[model samples]
Target: MHISHTSEDDNLKRLLSFSAIAIKSSCGEFDIYGEKDTDVRGKELVFERTRYVYNDALEYFEDNFLSQITSLGISLIPESDEDATI
Candidate 1:
């Protein structure tokens, strides 16, 4: 799945963007932005990290979001064969 977030706060935006990309990659899926010209099947999940503004958004996502999604039986596709060169 693809995940992303944006905020007026630069730090939060950066953190969320980084965390989203990391989470998606770790789950074996490429970041959405990286697949601009390709067709893929997956849901784009957005989180309101601003709610946990003071805490580490990355940690919260790992502890809360990742596990929850995994439990739901969603499978992350490994890097495509074409990406093997990279």
Candidate 2:
């Protein structure tokens, strides 16, 4: 899964305050959490099932989520520190 900023503003203040989408996949549940960007830093998951479910859920999210955000005129800014695994 990928997460990125979607605005022209790049300052840490602005970027940190922006809202971000968080996805959580469990054995029998797929959930999304939207919160301020700063809240996501260093967050980690320790469940084995989460990794498996995430892999499946992300395939669906990539196919469906990108178009939805693009249609809304949101431009995704890639994370400079990491490469997309997918």
Candidate 3:
């Protein structure tokens, strides 16, 4: 018997799906911080943590989840710290 393999296999699809979910979750957290962040220093800390979560998820997806697929691209994360605002 033989098997056929493709880039968008089941495991790879699951990985991409999970990454997308995690990134969305981080975005939600960023929004919540925007609402609840009152103090200047506290807000800065919140923003830094948000940045860490966003960038960490983005990098993890790039490093681990993206090597298998060729045509698919997720333009999920903001490209710059300034754009990361809001």
Highest-scoring model, lDDT: 1
TM-scores, each model vs. reference: 0.39, 0.21, 0.27
lDDT of 2 by residue, 1-86 (tens): 34376453344323222212232211111212324332222122212223334455534443444444332222123344225543
Ranking by TM-score: 1, 3, 2
Model 1 spans with C-alpha error above 4 angstroms: 1-8, 30-54, 57-61, 71-73, 78-86
Error of 1 at 14 (Å): 0.6
| lDDT, each prediction | 0.45, 0.30, 0.39
| 43: Cα error in model 1, Å | 7.8
Off by over 4 Å in 2: 1-56, 74-86
Candidate 2 TM-score, C-alpha based: 0.21
Give one digit per residue, the lDDT tens place, for model 1 in 33-85.
55432212222332433334335453564566555446322345344643775
Q: Model 3 residue 49 lDDT?
A: 38
Judge candidate 3 against the unseen true structure and give its global Cα lDDT, from 0 to 1. Answer: 0.39
Candidate 1: give its CA RMSD in angstroms: 8.1
